[model samples]
Target: MIQRVIQFWRAINAHLSGSDFDFINIYLNKKEQNLFFAMRLYDQRHVLNVAYTARRLAQKDGGSINEKLLMKACLLHDVGRTAEDIFLFDKVFAVLLDKYLPKTAHKLAKYNNSRNRSFWKKRRHALFIYYHHAAIGAEKLQKIKLYDIAEIIKYHHAPPKYGDCRELIILRKADSLN
Candidate 1:
């Protein structure tokens, strides 16, 4: 509970202080830039942090890694979370509900997208995205034909049994670090 509160505070802080992401501009192409900018300010900060961590880990590993693709995967990993524009209170409520009344949480989140729903209903939609953003992000990436990055996003949260990709493992670690 305390950890979540701290995380919430950090997220709010990140939202307030926007990220420039100028350091990575040279690495990303125009399309990737568009995608990166589409995310909310808080998410963009988080993505940048993750990318930094991934880069450090890759350097430490000293293994052959496609740095560009690894960075792309890190950038777009949470893009699907932006599908619903969620506020801080909504996120807090969702986390609490998910932790305690899980069944109710699932029910509310599942029904959140009904037309002309209330604020709480919209919050439920945000919660749904929180739980399933990885898969959702992977789907979006697939549309852009970034199949390799899509696979990494799809399995970042819960890796497959035959996980042999070092980049995927590094991405997961970096995400957790942030």
Candidate 2:
């Protein structure tokens, strides 16, 4: 609960303070920039943290990893969370539903496809994305021809099958650290 509150406060602060995109300009291409900016400010800040952490981890790991791809994966890993403009209460509810009533949460999330829904309906949809953002982000990345990055994003929250993906492991660790 305390962690969640801290995360919420940090997200609100990040949204209010606007990120300095200049720092990451050299790392991302035009298309990537557009996608990154399309996300809500809270998510954008989170992505920046994740990317920075991933890069640092890579450098500390002896420079064997492709730092660029790792950073890209980190930047886009939570892109799916941008599917809706979620508020703090919605996020808390989503977490609770995901933890205790997962099936119901999934059902509610899948039910609303129209953007013209009521506030509560939209909240449900956002909750669904929160739980399944990894796969959704992977699909988005795949559409942009970033197959390797997409694979890492897809399995960031879960263990990969082959279990030998060093980049995925590093990304997961970095994500958790931030």
Top of the candidates by TM-score: 2
lDDT tens per residue, model 2, 1-178: 6767777787788842334466557577887777777788877888888888888888888847877777778887887666254655677789788789988888788546687978787887777777787898788888889899888888899964676477888888888876
Off by over 4 Å in 2: 15-19, 83-85, 160-164
User: lDDT tens digits, residues 1-178, model 1?
Assistant: 7768777777888842323456557566777667777777778788888888999999999999999888888888887776245556766788899899998887777535556777666787787877787888888788888898889899888954574588898898999878
Candidate 2, number of clashes: 0
Which residue window of length 10 is worst by lDDT in model 1?
Answer: 15-24
Q: After superposition, how far is residue 74 of candidate 2 from its true place, in Å?
A: 0.9
Q: How far is candidate 1 from the true structure (C-alpha RMSD, Å)?
A: 2.6
- What C-alpha lDDT does candidate 1 achieve relative to the native structure? 0.78
Q: List the residue pairs that clash in candidate 1.
A: none
